[model samples]
Structures are given as C-alpha cells and as structure tokens.
Target: MSDAPIRVLVCDDQALVRTGYVTIFSAQPDMEVVGEAGNGHEAVSAAQRLHPDVVVMDIRMPLLDGIEATRKLAGPEVVEPPKVLVVTTFNVDAYVYDAFRAGASGFLLKDSPPAELVAGIRTVARGEALLAPTVTRHLIGRFAERLRPADTARPGRADLVRALTARELEVLELIAEGLSNAEIAAALFISPETVKTYVSRILTKLGLRDRVQAVVLAYRVGLVTAAD
Candidate 1:
C-alpha cells in the first residue's frame, strides 16, 4: 500500500449529510477528503479527475443515481476501478443487490457510527468488501429469497469449486458465513495475511468486486445453502 493517506470523495446530494461524512473522514489520521460531489454526475467526474482511493457514495442523488455512477466508475469493463462504498438510509431489496452488482465494495447505513465508518473505509481501501454482520445476516437472506432461481438457471454447485483449491474453498465458505479475516484465520489455524490472500484469489477467480458479491455467488453456486 502507498504511504499516503487514503483519499476519499464524499458524494451525497444533501449538504448536511455530505459535510457530516467529510467530517468523519477528516477526523481520521490516515484518511483525507480529496473532494466532494453533490450528485452522481459530479461524482463520476471527480472520481475520474481526483482518482480517489475510495468513493463514499450515496444511493439517491439529483442528476445521476449512485448505482449508475458506480457502474460508470467501477464497472467490470473498467480497467482499474476505484473502490465504492455505498451509503444510504437503509439496505433495502434490489438497492443493496444492484449496488453490489454495480461494483460497490460495500453497503453502509447513513447513521453508522463514526468508528464503524472509519473502519469500513479502511477495510474497502485494502480491497475487502465491508459487509456488516447485521447487514449480511438480514439483507442477504431476504435478497436470496427474492432472487430464488430455477435449478436449470443456477450454475452447477460443483462447478464453483473447479478453480479453487480445497483450502481456498474452505476460506470462501467461511466468508459466505460472514467471518472476517481474523476470524477466518483463527478458525482455519492460519494467519490473517494468508486469509487475505485466499479472499483475493476468490474474488479474482470469480470475477467479483468484494465479499458481498462473493457471498451472493457462493449461495447461487450452491457452495452454501440457505441453512448455512
């Protein structure tokens, strides 16, 4: 990682909320607010010009919405996409799934505590998706139900393991259950750094943005069942 502080762009239509997010990032010793955007159009432009390490994006905005902005900035076709952390009033339905599919590294609540906000930014900056335990347990389950697919449509469960080593697959299963790097390390009798490598490999092999997408893919591919 670079020695420079993590650069962030705070994007939200509401002035008060935007300023509040800037204040949170400003207070962090290792974070800097590079710029701010009041709408998604501004967000995409600032992201391209400033090239921030992370974009703290709000879902609703005046001109372009956060989902579309995220797509433009971090879509799969982009050569080097910046990390995006979606901040909103709530993680409701398609909003959460669509944001992740759009390439957001994580989803966070607007009212999240300052400490959590800081930790979240750091986590995403390190290339990990920030899936709050509460957010994952609740939202992911509902999302799975709403998106139930036919057996023929679902990718074969066995095919999911074709690219991953046994250890990597184990790490992925734990990740799908919402275990953090440290937690997964302890459970598997390995170091956190090793766990990070596995997570990175998983994302690369699956062409996913972050852990949120990994979890969704794990479920869809049948590596994990709803009972898990």
Candidate 2:
C-alpha cells in the first residue's frame, strides 16, 4: 500500500459508469476520487485543473473522444502528463491501438473486477504500464501486421534487446505472445513469483516505465513479430 492516496478523475458519457467507478475507487484506502467529467472536453479541462494522478477514461464521448483527450494530456506533445487508463466495454476495441499511440498507460474492460481496476490504477500511478497479455497482443501484433517491415525496424533498438539476459528475453517474447504471468511461469517452468521478478528486471534494464512501454518497445524494436 502506498503512503499517499492516489487522486483520480473519472470520465465517461454515462453517468452510471462514472458513479460506479467513484463508488469502487473511493472504497480503496489508497485512492480518492477528485473529479468526474461527462465528456472528453470536460475531461481535459478537469485534468488540467485537478491534476489527478490517474484518469479513468471512456473512448466514446461527446465533444471529444478519450483517444484525443489522452493524446492532449499524455501524448508525446505533452512534456509532463498524468497517467490515463482506458476503461471501455469493448474487448477487442478498435480504438485501443489509438489510445496507446496517444500515450495511454493501460486499457481495461469496463466490466473488469474492482480489484483489477484498482491494481491497474496503482500500477499506472507508480509509473508502470499494465499490459494484460490479451490486450497487448491484440494491440501490438495486430498493428504491426499492418506496417511495413522497414517501418518496424528501428536503429539502436537492438541495443536494448541485447541488454536483456536470455531469461529476460524469453519473458519478453512470451509477453509479446500475450501470455499471462501464470502462463509464462508454467511455460518457462518457473514460479510465478520468479516470472514477476524477471518482468520487473526487464523493465528496469530496458529503462521502461511500465508494461505498455515494454510492449511498444518490443514492437518498435522488432523483438516480436506480427506473425508471432
């Protein structure tokens, strides 16, 4: 548990969705609901004013959508940005790729259990990206398939790949394949705790803030192929 509470802003066009998140997040001792917005325009404004640690955003909204809002708030254009978590109903949402491209730290289904939602927020708040295996493959592999090989090949990215130990590299490939920690552990014949440790070490060695960044790095550096 963290010493300080993580302040959060909830954004969704549906009032019920916003209210539910407020109810769930407020129950956590280490989190607080600082504000709520009904649209992307309002979300952006509220984020700027409240400066919450995390923003729970919905993709479809009036005035602006979560994708654009995420871009404005956390995109490459922003020097300093708060973490944004895309909470939506779609399992394989088309906008997910755009959300990540726009700098979202994590993506979750709206129906996700409260525990996972809380974990996602905390993970992102701590400067770690949450790439649930399914979501990662759906976004990265699918997107890469549409790109040219030359575009995927990035110079110097191989240096980061070279930095990983054999074990860590194995973990990265499994992550690219969208295997859960437990699955990766089982496949690698190691304990789940060990897999977790390797994942953390991989992120640290690669200077990646989170799993989302790791997935991006894997794709950008051509560590994982779309066919894989």
Candidate 3:
C-alpha cells in the first residue's frame, strides 16, 4: 500500500450525514476527509478536482444521483478512477444494483457501525471491493430478474471458471450463497483466519479487487447461476 493517508470525499445531500461522516473519518489517523458535496454533480466535480482515494456517495442525491456520479468518476471511460463506496439506508435497496453497475467498489448502510464505515473506505482505497455476499446475492438477483434474455450470453465465462482451483471454486459457491466469513469457516470446517486467507488468495488469483467483483465475476462466468 502507498504511505499516503487515504483521502476521502463525502457526498450526501443531508448536512448532518456529511458532518457525521466527516467526524467519523477525521478521527482515523490513516484517513483524511479532503472534501464534501451535497449532490451528485458537485460530487463529480469534487472528484475531478480533489482526486480523493475514495468517495462516500449517497445513492439518492439530487442533480445526478450517486449512481450516475459514480459512473462519471469511476466508469470505464476514465483512465484512472477513484474508488466509490455507495452509502444507502436500506439493506436491499434496488439502487444498490445501479451503484455496482456504475462501478462502485463497495456499499455501506447508513446505520453501519463507525468502524465498518472506516474499514470499508480503507478497503476500497486499497483497491479492494467490500461487498458482503448476502448483499451481493440480493443485488445480482435483482439485476438478473430485470435483464433481458438476449443479454444472458456473457463471453469469456468458461475461462474464468477454469481459472479457479477446486478449493477456491468451493469457496466461490459458498460466497454466492451469502455465507459470512465465520459461517463459511464453520461450513468448510476451517478456521475464520483460514477463510480470510482463502478469500484473499481467491481475490488475487481471480484478479478481482474485492468480494463485489468476485460476485460479479461469478455471475458473469455462470459459476453461480442467477437461478441458483
């Protein structure tokens, strides 16, 4: 990791929400809140100017909305993109799908513990995705349900599946089923620390940044079918 502190930009229409995030992040020695915005358009502009490492974006912001802001900042068009961690109030919000599709690196509920928020920002800043499997499955299920049948044919899926080892493949399936690390360890008869190691190795071997990317890869490769 780089020696620089992880710079963050908090984007939320609610002033209190922004202030709360600022307070929480400012207390971290390794994190710095570089800027703030109250809407999506401002968020895009701030990202371009400030070049923060991570953006804590609210999904329902006015002007452009967090999904569009995320796309503009981290979309495929950009040569170098800042990581976006979407903030939502609901666990199963439909906008979460749009946020992921728009290149968001992670999702955090508004009521998430302060530590989880800090960890999420750091994880995304470190080039990792921070999707919980349950949240991921919910997002994918919603996406697949709305997808047209003609778009189901994803290319390069076979190669991705062939890339996984037997153990890694097992872990991937369990992940799709929405098992937490502790639960996954118990299910696999392994230690939680071992599970974390396997998860990290899986991310590296698969060339996936985080669990969110892993879920997307799993869906794209048909390793975990939408129906499953």
- Reference-based TM-score of each model: 0.87, 0.77, 0.76
Model 3: per-residue Cα lDDT at residue 42? 99
Selected candidate, larger TM-score, 1 vs 3: 1
RMSD of each: 3.3, 3.8, 4.0
**lDDT of candidate 2 over 1-228, digit per residue (tens):** 358899999999999888999999999999999999999999999999999999999999999999999989987557678999998887665677778777888888888899999999987886656776666665687775442222124466569788889999999888777676778899999998898899899878775555666676687667886656
Per-residue accuracy of model 1 over 1-228 as CA lDDT, tens digit each: 578999999999999988888887898889999999999999999999999999999999989999999999987677788899999996586788888777788888888888888898998898777886556655666565443322213455447556789898999888878788999999999999999989988877766666766777666667776665
Q: Flag clash pairs in model 3.
A: 129-210
Report model 1's TM-score to 2 decimal places. Answer: 0.87
Off by over 4 Å in 1: 141-160
Superior by lDDT: candidate 2 or candidate 3: 2
**Each prediction's whole-model lDDT (CA):** 0.82, 0.81, 0.79
Candidate 3 residues 72-149, lDDT tens each?
A: 997645668899999888666667777776778888899999999999998777655677766667667657444222
Superposition TM-score, candidate 2 onto the true structure: 0.77
Candidate number with greatest TM-score: 1
Q: Give the range of the ten consecutive residues with the poorest summed lDDT in model 2.
A: 145-154
**Which lDDT value does model 1 have at 12?**
95
